[model samples]
Target: MTAPSVVVLDYGSGNLRSAVRAVERAGARVTLTDDFDAALAADGLLVPGVGAYESCMRGLRAIKGDRIIGRRLAGGRPVLGICVGMQILFARGVEHGVETDGCDEWPGTVERLQAPVVPHMGWNTVEAAPGSQLFAGVEDERFYFVHSYGVREWELVTNDRTAAPLVTWAEHGGDRFVAAVENGPLWATQFHPEKSGDAGAALLHNWVRTLT
Candidate 1:
């Protein structure tokens, strides 16, 4: 089978080089681009974001990244988001008492975690949802994380019992937040798979396999 072609969106945010290297290592033909056409036409679209939610969203808007994502998903194409990339998929993001609108693909808000320690850095285990293809072989493994805010609660409602969204969880400082989500063609992880070492590599490989 041919290697999956993946576009690592370069919308002025994210660890682009690391993400590209990781995806390439996962056996995908990776392209780092800010072009809307490249992003929309890729076999897989990987959105990787770093830093604050507001700034990430700004960068996405500047390149019309959100529209590209929305358009891809509407066509039932695969799109993966990492860190703040995952956070901005929701309806809104609240940081420093200010709320910014998100892509609204999912109904929820990304808020600061109610944890004693801010920025839950380092490796952490995730409670993968049952039968999660994204965590198929990495259910018991830990992934690298670096963030201060997350979706503390899930609010998306699905009437189709056969296609309910799978929500994964992880805990830090006694606060459990949405670690990953698999909803049809949309997959996202709050942790950085590009930095999660071997476990991350396996997860990316699993996702790439789905494309083939």
Candidate 2:
């Protein structure tokens, strides 16, 4: 069996290297590129982001990464997003009182956490969705989180024709936010699996295994 091919979308994000290395360690033949064709044709596409939501959105749009994600998902191809990459999948994001439109793949808004601390950093445990494939064996393990803004609510409404998404949640300073989401052909995590140690590796392996 061959390792799954993965494209770590390079849209000028600062943390691309770690993501690339992590995915490679997770049994993937990783390529970090902004090339539309390579990104689209890969067995899996990983979108990693850091910094402000607006800046991330601007960089992603500059290379038309948003459209690539949409096109890939429309074809039932797998796309995984991390950190601000995950936030941009929502409908909009309000950072420091200004709101910017997102990719709108999931209908929700990312906003500043209603926590005592702004950036909720450090390792934290997540309540993985019951049927989540990504958290298969690492359901009780902790993952790293470092974000101030996230989707506090998931607003996608599913009908009989569409299956509902599996959502994972995490809390900080009494405010709970979306930690991960497993929707058809689309999976994302608010934390950095690349930095999450052993548990993170298991989660990444779970996802990479799906592609193969």
Candidate 3:
């Protein structure tokens, strides 16, 4: 089978070069661009951010990639967000201010991780919920994380997993924050899969598997 095309978003907020390298190394044709049209043309979209949520969203808006990303998600295209990119997947973000009018407010609220520190940087274990395609063979694996804000639990928790409380843990500014979330074809993580070594590569591969 031919490998699918992957587009790693380069909106000037994250290490997109690293993400592109990782995707290419995983046997996918990779394109690093800030162009929304190019992003829409790819088989998969990886939105990676390594800074403030509001700033990342501003960067995305500057290039209209936010529009493209929102449209793609609504259309059922597979889109993945890393770190701050993940927090932007929500409906509102309290990073700097309320996101009353933007893509961040589309899914859920983005809030600071109520942990004991800021920029939760390091490896953290993530256990996949039942029936998540992004975690087909991944039960419990550690991924590198570095962020201060994330999507709240109510946003990603589903009907099937209602009984299972949404538990996302990461530290930021002496408070705990959400770490990961998923809704349909849209999945977000508060970590850097590319920096997670083999397990991270496997995550990219697993994301590609969901393209079909």
Candidate 4:
């Protein structure tokens, strides 16, 4: 089989180089592109973001990234979001008492974690949802994280019959937040897989295998 062609979107946020390298190491052909056409045509589109929610959303919008993501999902194409990239997929994000609208792919809000610490930095383990293809063999592993805000709870409705969408969780300072989510062709993680060492590499491999 041909190597999956993956696009690391250049939307002025996140560690584009690290993400591109990691995805390539996962056995996929990678492209770092700002072109909307190239992004839409790839086997997988990776949206990596760092910094505040509003700013990330601004950068994404500036490149018409939100539209690209929405269109990809509507067509059942694969898209992966990391850190703030994942956070911006929700309906809104509240930081410093301000709420900014998001892509609304999922009905929820990305707010500051109710933790004693401000930025929840370092490695953490995630309670992967049952039968999660993304965490299939690495359920006990930890991933690197660096953030202060995340989705504390999942509000999307998923029936028992169709279980394509699964929500994973993690805790820090007594606060539990959405650690990862796998919804149809859309997959996201609050942690940075590119920086998570071996465990992160395994997770990336799992995701890459899902791509055509």
Q: Show model 1 residue runs off by greater than 4 Å.
A: none
Q: Assess candidate 1 and give its lDDT.
A: 0.95
What candidate 3 gets wrong by more than 4 Å, as runs, is: 96-102, 156-177
Structural similarity to truth (TM-score) of each candidate: 0.98, 0.98, 0.83, 0.97
Residue 105, model 1: lDDT of 95
Across 41-128, the per-residue lDDT of candidate 1 in tens digits comes to 9999999999989999999999999999999999999999999999999999999999999999999999999999998999999999
How far residue 101's Cα lies from its native spot in candidate 2, in Å, is: 0.8
RMSD of each: 0.9, 0.7, 3.5, 1.1
What local lDDT does model 3 show for residue 180? 58
Cα-based lDDT for every prediction: 0.95, 0.94, 0.72, 0.95
Model 2: lowest-lDDT 10 consecutive positions: 13-22
lDDT at residue 38 of model 1 (Cα atoms): 91
lDDT of 1 at 167: 98
Per-residue CA lDDT of model 4 for 1-212, tens digit only, reads 89999999999999999999999999999999989999999999999999999999999999999999999999999999999999999999999998999999999999999999979999999999998999988999999999999999899886778665788999999999999999999999999999999999999999999996
